[model samples]
Target: MTVELMATAEHAPHREEFAALYAQVQQFYAQQMRILDADADGGEARWAATFTEDAVVELPLLPAPLRARAGLTHYARAAAERRRRAGSRLHHWVGMLDVRPRPDGTLHTRCSALAHATPPGATSKILYVCVMEDVLVRAHGTWRTAHRRITRDDLA
Candidate 1:
């Protein structure tokens, strides 16, 4: 019994650290969705701010991965244009986050993302369901996404 108690005590701090890391990673994705789904114009800039200066975003529909702030800006502009054309209200639902700390001190996160859209005078519909894999790092004492790869769930 004493040996078991010692082992449990040794693992307690590690468990707390893991919990804290998981919460920070979850918060980062939640903030990303909030900024991306904002109703106000120019929210793309806000969304981009959540990323690192040299962040990379991989979209399933894009030909190549978007890199850095300039690439993010371009993607944001394109997304805005598409939304404007569609005239739909957009929302993102993130679920089931799995976060693990890497040996390099960064965190790897995988989560399900469900995008919904509501057209004028119409009910909301699921636009797409995707799984997002991300590498997050701590910069300036805050967690920011360094890399994000989105894979659409074809079976869904």
Candidate 2:
């Protein structure tokens, strides 16, 4: 085989690996959005399931970080309640994801999302812009979030 063909063959596996990781990251965020869009019933549990058992979620709007499944579940429940109270539904549009492989065999991703809310008898309005930094690990052949820090542009 020629040198050029040999080089391409050698790089094929790495390309596929990156592609798989990218797909996993995309799927993880998609699942999160799905959970957020879901109604209150059982939504907290579904959202908590997207994280690892010991995951930590940091939200700028919260006073303290949410640690572990229980805290995450609580946050999800509270979010659902807030939505219910306002008769609002949120739509999150994710954009400009930067995914990198970490040295510790994990994936680090930075992504931005624009959130819009539609309230009763009102048109949808942009609620906030969020930039999320996340660390994801693969366990049992599936990727789960280990840590997430969400920074809101509106807070600045």
Which candidate leads in lDDT?
A: 2
Native-vs-model 2 lDDT? 0.82
**Worst ten-residue run, lDDT, model 1?**
1-10
The C-alpha RMSD of each candidate to the native structure, in angstroms, is: 5.2, 5.5
Query: TM-score for every candidate vs. truth?
Result: 0.86, 0.86
Q: Which stretches of candidate 2 lie over 4 Å from their true place?
A: 1-13
The lDDT for every candidate, in the order shown, is 0.81, 0.82
Candidate 1 local Cα displacement, residue 126, angstroms: 0.8
lDDT of 1 by residue, 41-122 (tens): 8888888888899999999888989999778977887787788898988899998777766668787778889999999899
Give the lDDT of residue 43 in candidate 2.
80
